[model samples]
Target: MQQGAEYSLDDHGADGTRLVLSGHLTLASIGPFDRAVKAIDGPIHAIDLAGVEEIDTVGAWVVCRAAHRLSSEITGASPEALRLLASVQDIDVDGPMRPPRPPVWERVPLAVGDKVFGARSGIYGVVAFFGQILIGAGSLIRHPRRFPIKALVHQMELVGVTALPIIGLMSFLIGIVIAQQGSVQLEQFGAESLTVNLVGRITLRELGVLMTAIMVAGRSGSAFAAQLGTMRLTEEIDAMRTIGISPVEVLVIPRIVAATFMMVLLGFYASLMAIIGGAVVGDLTLGIPFWTFLARIQEVVPEHDLWVGLIKAPVFGLIVALAGCYHGLQVRGNSEEVGRRTTMAVVSAIFAVIVLDAFFAVFFTEIGWG
Candidate 1:
């Protein structure tokens, strides 16, 4: 039923139920629809949706309810009744469905470029790195008594002594392989006497120290980043600062200092094992007894070779420590951020170590020392 429309019901017609609405089917017209159905005097066995122009959920629901009651009164209702019910099935009472919008980049009001460096994250990273190192050193100097001796010992054990077996095995195996390869080429020229110098200089100046740095970067660097990143994500770094303690002092210095010393130890041990293993290979293939080869090493391997390896230790250590601490502190208080920073720390530290090794190689070569 609609405003300005007439409604009629034919109870005894061929259809047994005939209803008509002759105008627009709006919300305002449902009342007559309700009354006509209610006021009908016979069974209502069918309904029709053909006349509906645009019925809302409420209007649609009224038709459905009338049709249902009518069908119960009779044995079966026309499929028109079911069709009306089906048409409104997708309507939502919560609200009309709106398509989801994609996220848009809206400019934030604040100005980071003006406040910080205009366009220089690399320079900013360098400054922050040096600043954190100074803060760490000063904090240690100021509070020597409160330094984390227990944590230092624990970290030292983790990064140093516990890694000996794998380090020794790797260094020894590498020594054997390098000597075997060198023997094949040197045997052609009867220059196998050079094996001692080769093994000595290569192990001490490059392979030993370089490999040690990579191992430490992969081992200790990830640990430091993950530890501090967890703290950063939990706001424990903020808590330390709030309590008048710098996170660098409480977290970074111990790791940096420990890694510095451990790297030197690794370099020394890796060099020694490599030399010993190379000597074994020399005895087997070059007909040089172990002691004779050792004597040759003393004659040919210069003091500077050892010095180069030792000098690289602290640099590699600092790179690993700084990379780890930097990535850790960059964490933005999320578990995924902690994991990302830890992975970044390991990767960046290894890259820095290798890059610095290349620079060292160039420097030594320029000085006629390589």
Candidate 2:
């Protein structure tokens, strides 16, 4: 009674079907094994592998897959065969499903912590940039010939000269609005003539420099970030360093100096334009002559107001340039990072300008500038 490479299904007297597996129960016997499994008319009741001469993982897989299809008692399998079968069974079994996700309320603290740490890192980066710039300035002072005169001139033209028309238009409209609104408010108190004082004081002391700084931050600051960020992505900055060039000196100092100087000129120009616009509005709406409006401004607005605004312009410019350059240097990876850094540069510059303006306001007030 020789057992070949096959499986036999036999029925006992009213007993359930028995699967008797035989010789070389490996890949070579796959066809017979599959056919024998399929030949069972009903579900398997018992498995007898005592007759199987040899077995492998493939044969074990066939047996495991067949066993899962029916609730049957397996018998006479050797320890090695059983171990292989168990592994195959484990491979075929699905993993337990994952538990439900946590609620968003549980994630709030994590989000807040992330933002706080990010902001702290940003502050540290800005401080480090300031220190680097100072060191670069010292080096340039020692070697005046290394100063980037051409880059400074180019940045001045880009940041100041090219920005004139828009700055003029915006300042002019703001002055007109201030005059018109002041005239309306003061009319009830028979102080309509004071509209000149209102426009002159606000424009010279705050709005002129403040508005120009914001515009420059949005325009040139973002441009600096995007430009440097692109250079960084292309490894141009690395190339510069490889050739013994200092990026802080070549890329940063020129921009900061240019913006600071240009801002002074632009702020002065913006203030003058705004005052002229106020004069125009007074002449048309309040029936006051342009000469009278100008005279009233000169008489009522303290020279200290003009001095205060002029003093703030350079500081605001420095902040804008530093913020832009710092974020630009921080750029990593790809074009998307360039866009993100540009946005961050503009926002950080504008916010710093506003905060500095507030500090100046307090200091001036405390010092009896009014």
Say which candidate scores most in lDDT.
Answer: 2
Clashes of each: 0, 0
Q: Which candidate is the best by TM-score?
A: 2
Q: List the residue pairs that clash in candidate 2.
A: none
Cα lDDT tens digits, model 1, 173-200, are 8888888898888889988888888899
Kindly report the root-mean-square deviation of model 1 from the true structure over all alpha carbons.
Answer: 12.8
TM-score of every model?
A: 0.67, 0.73
Regions of model 2 farther than 4 Å from truth: 1-101
Q: What C-alpha lDDT values do all the predictions have?
A: 0.77, 0.89
Which stretches of model 1 miss by more than 4 angstroms? Answer: 1-119
Encode model 2's per-residue lDDT on 69-110: one tens digit a residue. Answer: 666667789998999888787764334467676688978888
